[model samples]
Target chain A: MSTNDPYDFSARERDILRIVVGHIIPASAAYGLPGADDGAILADILRSAWREGRKLHEAAAEIDAASGGTFATIPTGEQATVLQRFREQHPGLARACEVVTARCYYRDDRVMRSIGMEVRPPFPLGFAVEPSELDLLEPVRQRGKIYRDAN
Target chain B: MVEVNEAVDVVIVGAGASAAAFAWSLAETGMRILCVEQGDWVKADSFPSVGRDWEERAATDFAISPNVRRRPEDYPVNDADSPIAVANFNGVGGGTMLYAAHFPRLHPSDFRVKTLDGVADDWPVDYATLEPFFALNDEKMGVSSLAGDPAYPPKPQVMPPIPMGRSGVTIGRAMNKLGWHWWPSDAAITTQTYAGRAPCINLGQCGSGCAQGAKASTDVTYWPEAMRERVEVRTHCRVSRVETDENNRATGVYYYDGDNIERFQPAEIVVMASNGVGTPRLLLNSASERFPNGLANSSGLVGKNLMLHPYAQVRGYFDEPMDGYRGPHICTWSMQFYETDPSRDFVRGYSYQFSRGHGPVTAAVNGMADGLIPWGEGHHEAFRSVFDHSAGMVSICEDLPEEINSVTLDPNLRDSNGIPAPKLTYRLSENTRRMLDHSVARGREILTAAGARHITSRSPLPYAGWHLMGTARMGTDPRRSVVNEWGRSHDVKNLFVIDGSVFVTSGGVNPTSTIQALALYFADQVKSRIYDLFD
Candidate 1:
């Protein structure tokens, strides 16, 4: 159960994860999004994924073995094929990776601003939503009391 | 050796919503009041909203379900057998700390479900009697709403309503088109500055514990004011059981302090303001030679008549982007579907509580779970599709009291203090199932009218047992009830329960407002008869 066990990721495992995550959320210039392999995001994802401990190490080994030890050096299309097969074979591993990666990705300040959100936290300066039309209640006002009284 | 503290005039258990109001009200009588709370005061700044991992924190740390949160102060409640889980907060403000602040009062008919709908037992007290207490609580707790709704008798309010945003406008327009009754919701969060607390800045973080001090958790609203009036509160102290004298009169409580050392705090009067589950657990654990079945359980109804308001959550996705997470997501609700209809399949109906769909993290998590958002390629696309464009309502269905759905101590499981954990054994009734189906269908209608492209719903929402009530109900019949009309234990004249545990029927609305009002009313009754309170 210790995260700092011998089952911690190897150097080869880290390289495989880098290539795998890049495919999970590849860079999108059109959406102005960074791939999950982006330096800081990848590190954050791996740090968070460290909690998965042996599960992560085992998944990385399985993913690497599926690509014939060339997952870190596979072509983009071949990598996708390998990942798809791995996902089908090991659904839990795919989910663990996706959860860690997406958690780090969405919370990134760059990603938040790209999606039209304020970079800062919710408090101190919260958003000011436009005031809705109070006149909308006019029709309901005309409808009149809808409650029942038993007493 | 168990430390014995000096005897106080009064000792209230659990400094949550009910205890806060009761302590504040009874403080006026100049009696020495001490409230023992298991959880410490929550630092709002330490809330999840202050960090980038706010969503993650909310889902895990500030989670509404105590089973999920599992903080040191929280005791586990085994809910594996129940469809709806137990949701509660153990801190100074209790459930208010993590509530959505959607404040709504129970209707007049809610008090007389048995007579009006021919289901459940009727409350010994009625809305007319508790009306003044509700009004006073509104002013004291800083209620914000428009008062002219025809839903009930005219209500007097002090503040204007919270902004509905585009989400509210769309929902309102849709309801108006359907000719259903809807109104701006009453929120406990402040719209304008009151009692020195800041106004809501629309953080949309009320559910994760409001950092802006806008949402009125009793920790901020009542405790501070009560302390100024000389009411004392001991935090991080869990009450093990209430003690009774040879005459069957209440004496005090046995509790574990911050260091987990057992101690006895004696009192002249004992008030049980613990939430529905905790109140019953304590009373039952207090069984003595005189009352072996359970203290104040002469009618054997102490842990009976449990009602966890069965909830139905329905979300509709719109094509156009709408205002999302502005603040106080529950800004308005519809009572059109409230009240019993003889034609419907259920005895009582439910109110539709509307809100913006999800925050960024929650959206991604839910989308991933639903298989709509993928890991590779078009992950961003699926997120954008449902992120801001989705809106929904939670049909707050009224749960009729049933003795079968109850909370009893597990034979094996225990808290860190070795106290038995309450095991919730609840099952959704057939009436609730039909009511949820109809509510879901009606919800789709409203969302479609508002131009939603698609709709999704989770009936009898699994993680939505937020409104715990009716385990120990109030009635005049001593053989079938636990407490009397004034919330005093019928068997033990000196004991009182002023929490949701005393509710007779689970109304189709959040019970925090009604719970506080009842606490105030019970305090008033106790004061009026102070000369012979034990009699």
Candidate 2:
């Protein structure tokens, strides 16, 4: 949140964003799945938004304004209501924020592991999927010669 | 301003899929072939698989549409008027650089759509004539397929088909339940190592340029062999216009080199392998005083009847994880609806390509956009539910060629070389809309049978103009078509166009394999009739 930080967000804006994204994708202790505000996800989101030229801070400010400038201080249920209104008013910004948060959060190792996915590049060590059973394709195969003949 | 003055036996414009095939076919003939490509050779190491940010790079740098990619080598296409945006690559491998390599053949019926369906014109040549070339191309490109496809003639030797992963198995089971014809895809990617290229590692990033050289892109499949046979491929050379003699025969081409220097390369025979859009753009740009309208516009059909297969996709999210990112992006497809039936509301039918959902980041963005994953409160739950639990199918529907859906020069927009940008005028026909609705309904049924919890469907993707065809159609009549059966220009005898531009009908399938086959067939024709090629 400092000037030297990669994101262009102020400390207050970052605090509001943390609260908003936490409400958006709250951590589930039962599933051990980390939320958008967990670990480096907020930093990752800020960096990704900065790289994509998305106005995350502006969206944060809009959410704060909608929540009467106390979005971070508000209760979780109240924050969700304010965020929903912000989403309704600014759909594009909502989509951008959602995309950035989801992209950064789901790609986090803990979230990926919690979802039973390997947190590595898909290549070099790809997952082993069972080969298809030819018997399952027999019905379509029996219908046979569906193409029109060439004259 | 340096002019490269040279003469070759055959000067081919564009070192794309067709050009690669043509050059490889003519390599044995010892013809002095020179192919000019606008983009540089995409090295294997440069593929996105080597990096962690492959998904983001694929969306930006290696995107199928030039409008989005904005690469320096790419030419600007003014597709503002068209519903389907023009998507292609300008490099040595062309669109193959980022294609899924789904190498489906045109059905025997595709050649005679007019004779069978009573719509669209019949191709000048039939499927039987091109079957041998198809076989040859398949062998050379290391096609991973299974024989006895029933959709094709008896092809004896197809490499083992790529394993259909979890998504394919689920989809195949669903298709069977729905009593639909689904087959392990005939892909250009290799299964076992063939022709010195490595076998596929199942990276699921075939659309982002294959780093492993597994996907038989021409750079790895054909260009290497062609270059070894002394086919001169001058990369980063963008051809501006075809120069013609007094008799309206193509003398050679004027092109701009890497340094933006003008050069003229003369040749005995000039072949334009620059796909459907680029071929017509070059022909129209080559207007001479003798043929004032355009190079081969005696019929004014050089840029008419443009056809882009109207495409649609449906994604199904299931209760169980499908392991959607584990295999080739496209390894299974259904052709049950490929043939037209009177019971259907539309005249033509469409084929369904089953995809093993996209990579993680792509799925995130697409899922979010389609509301499969919501924004607030439930975002984590929604994302988790759909992350690996999705299957998708894309419909490649037949688009009838209409004169109004054409490619013309934009009066204002030009490329880096100051050549007029090709403006595409296209709209989905009523037939196409009907076909899409029918296809999507069937797609939903297949997904439903597979126990999908929810489904998301797009009627037609606006950025799905992958198969550009029929801008310069082939026919016997000189007045109705720009090229003849063998891709020879009707007016310019020595000129040939061996690309999707000569497709009489945009078959309800991917067109790359057919484009290569036709190029091989045309190369054979030139070899047999070299003495009288000009006459």
Candidate 3:
């Protein structure tokens, strides 16, 4: 997989990922900048793959080929459907997302935070609170609300 | 009747920095000199052109080849062919051909380390004695630096200093805001059109053999001038042993020529400027029946009290374009807090050097990730923005000498020549580990202040191959050191070892400038016949 080439996502995968990352690190519509869902973050991650000597294009192509349709062709609704099916049908995507979300958050979050975008959430199954008390950043606690405050 | 070989006045081993300086100085005396180099001759044109995105030579060990770089079976530290942990340049100027050209002198207190911080033993000679030699070395090397920089000790530079770029300016401002001391770094590069050489063009490829001849890599400066004076530089000749007589007076050396055949060359005096690791290994290999241990092991200090400069790195990603990977490898430094403070955990201090960020290829491997939808238009956009938005700095630290951190020959392993391999058994001191932790935290703070998007760093540890020094130190006492103040071994009269191996303590500063100055001083002592004073 050549990490340098732009990932040719199926329409469905593109729509879902773009929307997911936009919401993960939501972009400010008031700033006149493109929303995080504009696919900039995904493209940048693919470019980083190339820098790392990986074939992002090939990896994407394999996923596309396995889905029996190009990733760019699938709709966001279909991408969400295929991903849920992917969780049941294929083990690779499930394992890959498990690792990628945990690792890329620290490295990729800086730019997202700078531009007022939140990284998209991944694998909600692993999101349980730890036994210890949570220590959230002040700005995050005040501004970033993941769920409705019970109070 | 046996024929007597032609006698050279002085035979120097290893055509590295010190050897080149010694050759140039001795050539001025009109003495017949022969320099045997294990490497080939390299010229400025030999370097890869700047226009190309180049890969380093595999032989130079710059790439990531796990098997080829260091073979664990034959050599524990490195490979059989390149067994020593030290970086090797098998060309005209040795490793100086690929150095980053960041040259800072060890302070006066660095020499008297034992007295100041109460750590290692003090040098036989003080900074005052070697100050004149330092000026001579600076003048000869065409060092570019400025005076009145409060960050470092008091020493004037001969040439005008290089301009600090945007990254240096940003880092400098941030350091000041945080109450840290910083200054324009002293470099061994020609900043102006001085001595018929062009000034640095800021290609940022100084580590990979400068093609412009602006960087002082001995070949274009001292070695060429020495050649003009009729000094014979025999390249591709590896000196195996420095042969001595029954009376313990120096004779000459036996070396393998370009061919595998061995040849014996006789000379009056022998000088070994073959770097820190190689010099000690050569000495240990020169064990004769008369000298039961090694050539200069009367005090059993031939290869004891080894030291290495432990370094840590901090990388920052900034919003504004820093243009960091565009200038010289090093042009700015922070030496304001160079003196030892008892409040700090470490006995000695460390200097923070602002240097080149990772190039494109390495950054992708280290910076980018898969989570952001690797399959699409998003990947291309991320690649373009991050390349220009990165900045980084390095911490050049001082490591106190420990007797346990010694270089011994591996009993079971051997090189291609069937020679025993040098085994480096070194671990970081508790003080050094603590120092690294402090420096990394400080670096993180600086990056955050500079508005870094995110910062990441490895825990502080001793990295191999930046600046290795002090395997064989210099002192008056035979039991404490291997060489005297002039770099001549105390046990042997005519055998001199001029290199970083003669450093008494691994100062926080880079040792190249001091190494060159000490080499010039050793040459002066030899030329003026100052042995009478010593006797």
Candidate 4:
């Protein structure tokens, strides 16, 4: 699917993207916003990701080239196998994932402002200033547990 | 030709929180009621998350009237076309469809703040009088909370408490340790399945509109029930005036249909549930020579004493990512330090509700360094860093009623119907200003106790229109208030104004629950033949 489209996602691309976002933000699980069967919003994100040239399948291709097996063809469980290696070994992939998720989740900067919040960088890393409180206990730091059972 | 509409026993205006409840209460009376809603109907399946495409605009109603420009005399604080500053939905449920559903009752002490604390005017009725109605509102709205907690009055709750995440627990623990009272909020959302609706899935998208049908929006609960009882909901109709006879008996109403065509419908009575802003605007425009000041304004108190629940936020970043952004919008209670205490410097109190973070787009706007320029990569990174790393508390402060703060007709501006819009002039009182400072200090202290790495706080910049209330106050005296204790216009018989506009005082909590309770009570009063007092 073309990224220029408002919300377009391929099935395979959506499945992997949904699980990744669910693992990254786990709150979506509490609202039942993201379940294994619910592929709607997840599909949109993946489509947007592809349009942005940060396609998960393509990124998986790079990971496959660096490691051995291709990421696109791997089974659900095996997909985790490939990502786990990079989360631990490839610092670049971990940073890239963080960057990608932040950009995707906070796409509506103007909407957020209407409600009295601004988006800024994480401080030192970037100087974008949105007024927000810092959270020390972010679940993403618990990276050892791949694919949290919930989201 | 104008669409001469069908007649009903009562013609109600607006479909937000107040209007929905009014329709729900009056529907069972077997009276032919017509509710003219300005918004359309929205169901759960039509929400953003459940749509066929992720960004199909997702059933959102953005109703910015293009043709109408607000005159300076009409909405001095806003653009000509944007006389009303509130972001309301153009749907069947109105703002109820989009609200976060935080249901908190104004404390008993809230009723007599003026007499008790010497702050503002006293409510014509006390909390004890309205307590039964409050319970009634809780039952119908499906409020979820453990009510036996001594902090609030004894009331029955339908849904159980929504589980607070680590952030709520941390704040709860920290606040309790400080000898403050905090409980799970009484939100009008189903914690478990009730009345054909599913339990809250905790998607934290309460603000965006609940797709799971868990939130107790009027459209899902009251409007449907009203529809079953045969309350006719007319969408896309904007009511402009309430026609009254020389005796001041409400006869009918005039409005514009979807096509901007003027239409008139007669009725036995008129109930203005058009909320704080809309109600006052209508009254200010319904001016005739017989009632030169305004409709039902014999005492000239129709659009005076306007108030809003001025609010601010205090942020706290803990050592761990509390993941505060993951659950319902407001899952925890507030510290009632100044709620009833007579020892406080301020006359009224303020309450706080804990909040989670927003999505990336929202977060970016929030991270837009409070006083910085609009753009840059540095801005983008700042937004990303705190993507999942923030949580805060919202402080809803009670605004003291001031005669100077008001909504009046703009002499020059006109709405789409060629009727004058309400021009508001408001400023925060010195006492409220001090209260904001005091609450910010208390918020910072609590965040510090919770071991926050960074804490930030904000206060309203003077007259920031937040919680609109008290424009047409209720009291026995026609000289001071507009409506009587029963919300019936003291000056005009058969003309009743429900909603936040009739508030004698703006309490330190959300007005939805209280307003719903008042609507139920007034409906019962009308049903019980007490309205004959005027006849």
Which rank order by TM-score, best down to worst?
1, 2, 3, 4
Most accurate candidate by DockQ? 1
State the lDDT of candidate 3 residue by residue for B494-516, as single tens digits: 88999888887888877788888
- DockQ in order: 0.60, 0.48, 0.03, 0.03
Runs in model 3 with CA error above 4 Å?
A1-151, B1-5, B49-51, B55-85, B368-379, B460-463, B530-535
Report RMSD for candidate 4: 13.6
Kindly list the per-residue Cα lDDT of model 4 for residues B276-316, writing each as its tens digit: 77788888778787777887776677767877777778877
Model 2 lDDT tens row, B65-126 = 99878889898999988878988998998988888999999989999988888998999999
Give the lDDT of residue A116 in candidate 1: 82
RMSD of 1: 2.6
Poorest 10 consecutive residues by lDDT, candidate 2 chain B: B372-381
Candidate 1 achieves a global lDDT of 0.86
lDDT of 3 by residue, A2-101 (tens): 2243444444544444443433334344433343344544655333322222332333444565558544566756655555565456545444432232
lDDT of 3 at B501: 84
Please identify which of the two predictions, 1 or 4, would achieve the higher DockQ against the true structure.
1
Model 1: residues >4 Å from true position, as ranges? A1-24, A49-98
10 residues in a row with least lDDT, candidate 1 chain B? B364-373
lDDT of 1 by residue, A1-151 (tens): 1235633666787887788778777777889889889999988877766445566777788888887778878788898899889889998888777666677887888899988888878878888876858899998889887888777
lDDT of 1 by residue, B1-535 (tens): 9999999999999988999999999999899999999999999889988887777678777989888788999999989989999889998999999998888999999988878877787788889999999999998899999879888788898688898887888999999889998888999989899998889998888888999999999999999999999999999999999999888889899999999899999998899988999999999889889899888999899988889888888888888877676678788889988888888878888998899767776777677766767867788888889788888899998888888988888888888999988988888889889988999999999999999987888888899888889888899998989998888999888889999999999888999999999999999999998898777
* Models ranked on lDDT: 1, 2, 4, 3
Ten-residue stretch with the least lDDT total in model 4 chain B: B65-74
Tens digits of lDDT, candidate 2, A1-151: 2343435778787788788677667877667677788859988777766544335766876887887778888888888788878878998877677666766776788877777777777666655666767767677667777777776
Superior by TM-score: candidate 1 or candidate 3: 1
**Candidate 2 or 3, higher lDDT?**
2
